[model samples]
Target: MATPPKIPGLGAFADHKSGTPRPATPRFVTAAAWFLCLAAVMQFIASVFAIMHSVSPERRAVLEAQHAAMTGNRPSLEALQNIDVITVVLSALVTAGAYALFSIFLVKGRSWARLGAGILVALTFIQLVGVSYPEGFTTLAQVVCGVLAIALCYLPESSKFFATVKSSRS
Candidate 1:
């Protein structure tokens, strides 16, 4: 059989104690990458829904009436506020952009991305632990996103990335 191809920095997987390079990615980072990708896809779908629903005046009216009855207050849809479409689009764009940047950093073994992803996970967890919002799906999504983000940070690939980064700094 032919010999296995050699990676430049990696000495051998068996030599774990040596100063050989392991995979730059840890498990957590891989999870985080998947999580971010999911979030991006969800955001894109939500943006499309928002854009389509924003212009549905009939649907808006029903929602507004329901809101008025539930809250005993004037609904914000009074202006026929299709402006929410913009907000949704902007959110989708921002999330997509963040995902792209995070993916690049993940591939390059950037430690800062790991830290930032951790922080985001914490914040998302807070959303789950905090009071439930009126929207059920939003809460569910937040919990899923948070859990995945945390999982990514804890993975082996992520650990390696962080370790490499620390070693470089020192």
Candidate 2:
């Protein structure tokens, strides 16, 4: 196949046969990346709120009462609260980290990242259910952003962009 002639002053090249320039990353994909970033930030904030609430005196009292009723104080309240904080921290790191990493790859047009993002959004929504007051609001915001990001990633222009990137790589 003959190579397309390089046009002066233009950094991009046209296809030799079709004479059309390569498609640029679509706005939908860029928007999706932003939404993913927003979700990640919200997830982190929610985790912080959860940690703060869990360690508060009032919350500790409630937890202590619940623990007394449930286990007859087999495990101390401090022990249970420590475990809860650790779990929240680890979960936040994983979820937020995944969102940040996937957003970078999704912007680069990785097909797998798009699918992973969708799965993450669904899982996040399910997990956020029954979350309490302040943290619940943050989780709700995170879920909304996640849903919007996944929706944008699956839009027609974004789909075409991913397909083009996939074909070019192969």
Candidate 3:
């Protein structure tokens, strides 16, 4: 068998104990990457549904009624429903798309990607919380994914992957 190519820094699969020039990509980061990607896919699906239903009169009526109930003030269907399509598209493109893009660099143990993911995950949780309480399984799923992504990235098991060699060695 041919020998594997050696990279100068952050090469493949360097165990935590090894004195390699670069730290290995830990399992936690790997898991977090998958989780973030999954979140993005799910968010995209949600956006598509929002857009598809947005033009339906029944859907518009239901949303308007729900809004009025939550806000304790009646609002016209045109006022409430007009924004749904644009809102969902913007959220998908910006929020979910950014998460998907950042996850690529995140796997390489980039600190900025890690920090961005953290902030994105936090924003996801905040958005989830804004939803009405006593939510169903779908809302729970969003919260769980966000929390899990944060935990996987920051927990000690995977933290070494992002640390500088000098710090991890000390």
Candidate 4:
């Protein structure tokens, strides 16, 4: 089999086929991974805050008043709230899990992990709109970390690193 041509300035990373030691993870990728981990933690905290805020006495009172004013129905409103809580819990767990899993694979130089993280970041941004203040703050922090992670993962150094990993795998 013909050896692949060495990419300029990436010879060290691309030479894995020759059994030389693999290049150290790039700083950009490392930073991206840490940012992803931070995002995951922040997402979980934000979810908890959201759940607390949603079930607070004050919020319950407001919801009750709204329901009473609209349809004079309590049972339906209670059911709706329960569904909302369950949805939020499930969404939070899935999102945080994806962020954590992708971060681990990203550190190990999996090219697909970055793409998955980027998609999650986009979804997080959409989910954060119109959140209540307490949870909003945590969500905002998570968004910042997620944005930074995605940005870092697309940087030139990170791109090269992923490319090297992909080529080595082939």
Candidate 5:
């Protein structure tokens, strides 16, 4: 196989076929990418914990109602335990997929990815505003990851890298 030729206007790693002069990816941008990966993993774990070991509260209530109507008693703990696990598992999978999907685009330096990341970060802040952090390191780590991902994306060097990618598009 032929080694790929280096081309004008391309970054060191860019394929010669592209012939686009993408700048070296900025350190801040790389940091942000890694941080996003971390956030995705954390979110997956959190989503699992958010739904573990019990049926959803609403569904559990409905099941208890039915049981009471039929036999004048509530649903058993054992019956409620795994009844909603499948639904919760599916939701957790979706959450994990979204994180992985978005991070792939962000790492590629797609403009839409940057915009989406920005919006997500804004939403995160909005969701958490004035909420006290629970006593856990994960929440703090998540905050740091979110803040860094947003802050780093707009730095001068990162902006230049993004601009170069845009300007050099074929």
Candidate 6:
């Protein structure tokens, strides 16, 4: 086989035929994409838990007392019972859609996938910050979830996938 000619600075990367830069494939990034999908699943589960778990009677009493103190009268339980289930469902659907988009981008090795995952990680981190300042168990879980999502974003498979995407674009 004839040795391909090398351009001085390009070294082994020099192309003899087209003289254009070629891209190399990344091996690990695709696996990290699963994190986006898993987050959507977890969000759905959290929404379900939020909707199904009733407030404890003690909590309700505390709320009632607070309300009475503020309004000079007890608020009816019926008012509390009027929770908007539709809103929660809609939020879940939106979250699921975002996940689907992210999954598609990840699988296809689109450059946008990295941006999307980064944005998702940032959002999770913001949520964690909000949770942490409050010092509640709920916030702790939020932080854990955020950490997991961020970790997944940096997984070898995900990095490889994104690298392939970057190379392809070049």
The root-mean-square deviation over C-alpha atoms between each candidate and the true structure, in angstroms, is 11.1, 9.1, 9.3, 7.6, 7.5, 11.5
Model 4 lDDT-worst window of ten: 11-20
- Tell me how many clashing residue pairs each candidate has: 10, 0, 0, 0, 2, 4
Model 3 — which ten-residue stretch has the worst lDDT? 130-139
Per-residue alpha-carbon lDDT of model 1 for 37-97, expressed as tens digits?
6755655754566566667777687767766777555647745464566666786687666
Clashing pairs in 5: 9-20, 9-21
Please tell me which model should have the higher lDDT, number 1 or number 6.
1
**Could you say which candidate leads in lDDT?**
2
Per-prediction TM-score to the true structure, in the order listed? 0.57, 0.78, 0.64, 0.75, 0.63, 0.53
Error of 6 at 56 (Å): 7.6
User: Which model, 2 or 5, shows the larger TM-score?
Assistant: 2
Q: What Cα-based lDDT does every candidate model obtain?
A: 0.60, 0.83, 0.70, 0.82, 0.63, 0.55
Candidate 2: global Cα-lDDT? 0.83
Tens-place lDDT digits, model 2, residues 31-52: 9999999999998898888889
In the range 1-170, model 6's lDDT, one tens digit per residue, is: 99978556452222234333334333334344565666676667666654554355654675567666675565566455344355567877886667667666656556565566667657655655433232334434533544554465567765665565555545
| Number of clashes found in candidate 4 | 0
Candidate 4 TM-score, C-alpha based: 0.75
Q: Please list all clashing residue pairs in model 2, or write none if there are none.
A: none
Best by TM-score: 2
Tell me the deviation in Å of residue 169 in model 3: 15
Using TM-score as the measure, what is the rank order of every candidate, best first? 2, 4, 3, 5, 1, 6
Error of 5 at 8 (Å): 27
In the predicted model 4, the residue pairs found to clash are none
What is the C-alpha local distance difference test score of candidate 5? 0.63
Q: How high a TM-score does candidate 3 get?
A: 0.64
Q: Candidate 5, residues 1-170: lDDT per residue as tens digits?
A: 99979676455233334676556777788888888778767666655554542446765676677666775565575565565666657765764465555566556665566677766656545545554445234445655686788688888877777777767764
Off by over 4 Å in 6: 1-27, 54-83, 129-163, 166-170
Writing each residue's lDDT as its tens digit, candidate 4 over 19-95 gives 44445789999999999999999988987887787787887888788778775445777775787689779988999
